[model samples]
Target chain A: MAVAAVRRLAATAPVPVFVARGGGTGLLPVELAFDARLRLVVSPRHATVLVAAGRFPGPLGVAVDRVHDQLPAPRGTLWWTADVDGDRPAALRDASVVTDADPVGSVVALHRDLCLGRIRSDAAVLADDPPNRFEGRGDHGQGGEGMMGGVPWGRPMAMTGDDRDGLALDRLPVVLGPFLPGFPNGLRVHAVLQGDVVQEAKLEVLDLGSGPRLDRLDPAAGGAQHDLRWLAEALRLAGLGALAVRAARLARAAPAPASRAALARLVRRSGLPAAWSGVGVIDGEDARARLVRRLDPSAPEGRSPGPSLERVAEVLVGQDWSDAVVTICSFDLPTDRAEAVIEAQA
Target chain B: MTAQAEVWAAPLLTAGVLAAGAYVVAVLDAAVAAAVSGAGIGRSVLAGPLRRAALLVVQQPSATERPDAASWALAPALYAGLAAAGLAVIPWSASFSVADVEAGIVLWGTVESLAIVAIFLHGWSANTHQSLLAAYRFLAAGLSYLLLSMFVLIAAAIPAESLQLSRIVESQHGLWNVVRQPLGLPLFAVVALGSSTWGPLNLADGDDLSGGTTADVSGRPRLVWSGARAAMLTSFSAMAATVFLGGWQGPVLPGPAWVVLKTLVVLAALVASGHLFARVRTERFVTVCWLVLLPLAFLDLVIAGVEAL
Candidate 1:
């Protein structure tokens, strides 16, 4: 009886969905932001439903499969795509598909069915085994030759490096997301870190030949609508989810002068501008300046094109992890143009 | 009441209060978030936490490749246990408390320090870089605020001339420490925020590293971690009430009721602060804690000493 009660209560919970965003999924975020029935989780581990949203062409689908396996048991997947009938990723071949404008209802139903045992949880897409063999080639078998360096299970141990303080410390290398929370969907960073400070960093953009641009779904997503969308994402990255939701709601409706002014006041009162001041300075402008400008009604309509990813990476060096993330999110890079540049280089 | 009744009743009371406090913290968080987002206060705000907890129960936890599974599970339990230990020191009424030791303030201090270990273990046991980075970042920042807490607590202990929390509450009968040492409550609030890792001090489980320490945690374990955090916040509020706000002292209402009401107010203030402010950068926060807040805490301690003289 208690088990049944738990299931009933679980069904009433808002569906915790982790969205593996593919290209051209701009509208999905705005829709999910205000939908009380669905909660967009930052991590796959925290999610019950893994929604593979938008177009995942080629290798991106493999990344989605990896994310799918990260979800805990009693998990389900839904494919929310524009071209549902054309071709589905192998991971979503037998999964439920939604072609609707808003996939909240579908996600909610999927969560409820899973809770009530009406449908079986999806099986793991990848094998349940370690990626590399566990072996050591050191004197004490601690990985390195003497005591402090070697790959244990294909994962490199942190090596000593000169830190900002002129002290030697272990420097660990990390690759932050293509699908990482607080980052633009396709943006990734490869960084060597000493403690939480980034020692060296570089941008790694994914190939997007398989999918359309992010803004292709909505041609009207420019000017005020565009800035608002960016503001919402920036707010979320800053750990202000409530404000992000407010920004998203504003973006969804026709913008009014009064509402925009109120939001700007609220933003200032929240101390975001203060916290973000002097953070992630690029060229001559800091994050605070850019954020304030975006909220300024008469400042400008279109944003200036952002610096190249390589140039941005140069700025990322020596910043703390949190500041680096906020810095990356501050720029207004056109994904299509960035992709084009990468393609040209190739 | 008989000794046998006291034995059973004391634990029951403390557990019941802690559970209620934690639940209220969660509900208050949801309500504050809703209000901040312009979603409005609704019945759903209250029910949200319960429903989410139920979902966590029904879901299954994920396993990382080669995590310290024992510590991964033990982390939340240890964290929650520390919160309970902190709560156990505060007397509900003059005659009631689980363990009103002579050095209850010291006991609470120990709980605050040990929480750093519990939080670090939660992140490090995951065997993931982001989690490990969070753990490291927390350690670097934790020491700064912890010292501030010590100063604040010692300042509150000056007039009472006793390390006992109940005595401190009794001492506040003349004039609350919040008024006596005006900087005491706000400085101690920073300690509360830092020890619990909530609001601007939420470096361990922040959004930039994708939930940071909690990045790879989910399901039942996630529920425990979340609850443990809320419980810790509740414990801090209760401690703040006891230390500065005159725990169970008020006119008209019963002593225990006064304690409960004061705790709720502190808890609400903490939760609202969590929603209202953007996360401060880690390096910046650590700098402020040491350079600015630490000096203010010293000033508060000096004030309390002057008053005692």
Candidate 2:
């Protein structure tokens, strides 16, 4: 009886969704923001449903597979625009694949079915093997040479290195996100971190297909809506969920001057502008200034667009991970152009 | 029942009450947080904890590569146990404490200190860079709050002249600590939020680290860890009520009812504060705690001491 009750409750809970964006699928975020039943989570671990929206390049297939494996069991995946192909996991073969249709309704339906136990969740696709095999050469067979330094289980132990703050600490290399929350879709960074500080960064840009360019949109309608989307994402990253939601709502409402002013007032009252004032300055305007300028209709078109991923990596080197996220979100880089530059650089 | 039987059963009953209270507090916290964030309070809001509980129950437990599996599994239960132990000394009414020792205040303090260690274990055992970073961040952030908590708790105890929580409540019969020591309640509230790692003080599971210590945790273990966090917040709010607002003391209501009322109020305030402020950077938060909150707490303690004399 208790088990049945628990199952019912689980079915009713807000669906935790993790979205992976493909090229030109900016409309999905707007749709998700308007949906009250869905809760957009930052990490795959927290998600019950992994929604892969838009085109998935061939290169990102393995990365997508890794993300798919990361979700806990009794989980489902919704392929909004693209389907897994060639060496795909068996579980994903049976996954919900939505192509060339309105994905919002289908995604919601998938979540409902998943929670209701109407659909059996995908099983683990990857083998349940440890990341590294332990073959240490020691008396106890504990991997490594000396007490402080050695490779353990085919992975080298992080050795002490000089940090940005001048403190010597063990530096660990981590790959953060092609699908990480609070980052632009397909932007992955290889970072060497000392504690929480980024000591060094390398950029990897996945080439998802190009979508509608923001610059081509009508300045009165699409431009205001586009700017609001950036503001919403920035607010969400800063742990300001309510404000983010409000911004999204403002974007949906007529895209009028009155609504825009209200959105600006909401941003100011949120105290986020003041808090983000000096953090992550781009083109001489900090994150707060950029956000404010985006909200204003009369603000001049200033500075050349499309800061390279390498430039972003340079800016991120010494900043705390939290500040770095804000910095990255502050710049509205055209995804297609950025991808082109990244490919050229490579 | 015999005296010995009563002694044995008293703790068992108190444990049940604390567990129930913790569940209630968690639900109420969700409601209040949603309401304050402009998400209208509804029947659906109440379903959140239940739904999360159900989801966690059915999901499989996951581990990172080369994780300390034993320690990883142990941390959540250990955290919850410490929270339950802290609740043991908090008297529901004058005669309703599970373990009303002579040094009950000190006992609560020790449990809180152990919570820091337990959280560190949870983060470190994950074997992920983000998790380890979160663990270290908690240690750095935990220090300032720990000192602030001790000073505030000691300040509250100074007027009572007894470490016993019941005695402390009795001392507030004439005037509550919030009235007598102006800075005491706010200081204790801040410390409680920090100690429980909730709201602005939730650096251990903050967004920057993508859920931080809990980044890799899922299934039943995740439920336990999150529930333990909620339980810790409930316990802290109860302690705050007991220490400063005159626990179980009210004009018209029964003693237990008053204790329950005050606890809910404090819990509501804590949850509301969580939605009000964005997370502060760890270094800046530490600086503010030490430079501003510490000196203010010290001054409050001195004032309490003077009043006691």
Name the candidate that leads on lDDT.
Answer: 1
Model 1, span A109-148: residue lDDT tens: 9899999999999888877665666455677575676666
By TM-score, how accurate is candidate 1?
0.94
Alpha-carbon lDDT, every model:
0.81, 0.73
What tens digits encode model 2's per-residue C-alpha lDDT throughout B210-247?
78899899889998898888888888888988888999
Candidate achieving the largest DockQ: 1
Please write out the lDDT profile of model 2 over residues A45-70, one tens digit for every residue: 88889876666656565577778888
* Residue B74, candidate 1: C-alpha displacement in angstroms: 1.5
Q: Is the docking of candidate 2 incorrect, acceptable, medium or high quality?
A: acceptable
Deviating ranges (above 4 Å) for candidate 1: A27-30, A85-87, A130-154, A210-221, A336-346
B1-309: candidate 1 lDDT, tens digit per residue: 698997888667766777888799989988888898888889998888999999999988878868999999999999999999999999777777779899998999899999999999999999998788778888878887899889999999999999998888889996898888888889888888877888777888987677888999988999999989999999999999888899988999998899889999999999898877877777777899889999999998888888778
Q: Which regions of candidate 2 fall more than 4 Å away from where they truly are?
A: A1-5, A82-93, A99-102, A127-156, A164-168, A211-219, A255-271, A282-284, A292-306, A336-346, B1-12, B36-39
Alpha-carbon lDDT of model 2: 0.73
Q: Each candidate's TM vs. the true structure?
A: 0.94, 0.88
* Alpha-carbon lDDT of model 1: 0.81
